[model samples]
Target: MSFTDSSKKSDPANPKDGSSSESEKPSNEKQPTKTRGQNKKLDRSSKPKTPLPQKMDEEDLGICIQITEKLSNSVYAFGFRSPPDPTDEDGQSYLSATESPMDFQTLLNKLNTEGYRTVNEWKNDMNLIFDNAFNYFAPKTMRYDSAIKLKDKFTDLCQMFTKSEEERWMIKIEKLCNKYISADNEQ
Candidate 1:
């Protein structure tokens, strides 16, 4: 059975007697061959493209800064105020559990430099900070509890921020409508 033997064995259907059977002959039809990365190319091409990030406007940038400031100032945010130190004792655990890490300082830096294009993008990073903390710390641990509190605070802050923005827009619209009506009345 060694490949290097170079000795030819008699075929099962066509034995040493030189008799051949028609059913055992090779077929003329060629079997299809598969190439590497063929399916990967199709998958990548078929995937939907994500739109590029838009630049953050003044108002959006202000909101981003304000949210980050508020979150950073919270008592529950003490642990997540800065980036995690991977060289520290708990570093390996943090690195292992959190897929993407975030911190208040990093968020603030991004906001100041207009790193995020939308409020939602900034919000996602903020959420990631708490999520990372939660993932790294055990359920009953103080750090985990802190993360829960911070997450709740962030949620409340965002809801209030959105409502205030909507209210401001509505007030502006109402004033514009009033001015239009007053101008029509004067005519």
Candidate 2:
């Protein structure tokens, strides 16, 4: 007999249907399969991409102030004097100087004077030097005052000058001042 005819035959004990097996029915009777690609396409079309945020000049200024404040706080916490109050003479000197007093030039000078051959050598012991200086010269009250002054100067600079220019000055000042204080303490 043909395979189809054999499958159509029913057993005497179970005669609910003429077919012996349910799987022998046509595949067209079953539902279609869903794929991962199809599901992803549907998900993509359902939602849109979020737009990028806009940049602002004011945000840059705010960031500059934040950086300055942090540097100031760190210097004070490490027991260094806050920046000196600028008198008219100090202001004039600062303006006339080719570079900011806080610049790395001072650091280079200190390293040379101390007989260090490389910048890396100075950088390695920088923290210890800073701590020793802080312990020697900076009273608790001075640290508090310096932190406050540093915050104020940062705000004033942000309002009065360009962010990038102010940042250069602030960085130079921070490094030089820290180095000087530390060196003095070492003595």
Candidate 3:
């Protein structure tokens, strides 16, 4: 059934007459607009106050942990397969194993190969740098909370990567960030 506004209906005290009482006038009638502090019914100032999270600035790291839980579900929503362990230097060798002269560069080059796609192609996704780094390092078989911890670690690593801005080391960073951006324009 469709809903009707209670104010539009006549007062129950006098059923026959369709007129609303003085207290319940039709909304179309003009009522004096209450200024910020004039209304006594809803004394927003006197209401029980809760500590606002917004007051907690970027310095609040606990907020980071809270957000990572949400990011875990989001990353999974897009569908992800965890990368090989960082310690296993030879873990992702299979991507380049088919070639006769398999090496680290070949593995990095795989990102540019056909069917490979990065998060964004046309531009650098500075915003999602943390997300991508986190996904890259997180274990394949981890749950939400564990994944969050891993994400935080990766985030710190990304920060260091940015801070250590040596051009020689940045070339690979640029390549990985730019590669696999858009599937439509496979570049």
lDDT of 3 by residue, 156-185 (tens): 534422433366357656766667565537
Global fold similarity of model 3 (TM-score): 0.19
Candidate 2: C-alpha lDDT: 0.45
Best lDDT goes to which candidate?
1
Compute each candidate's TM-score over C-alphas: 0.59, 0.19, 0.19
Q: Tens digit of lDDT per residue, candidate 1, span 67-185?
A: 77987998888888987788886765666566777899988988887798877788889888877776567798988999998888778877745667778688668978999999999
**TM-score: the better of candidates 2 and 3:** 3
Which should have the higher lDDT, number 1 or number 3?
1
Q: lDDT of each prediction vs. the true structure?
A: 0.77, 0.45, 0.39
Where in model 3 is the C-alpha error above 4 Å? 1-142, 164-187
Q: What is candidate 1's CA lDDT for residue 10?
A: 62
Q: Write the per-residue lDDT of candidate 2 for residues 1-187, one digit (tens) a residue.
A: 1112344556645646754566554466666677767655445755787643332233343443344345435554443323223576744443343122232233334433543443234333333333333333335566446545544554455453444767857876897899999999999
Worst 10 residues of 3 by lDDT: 114-123
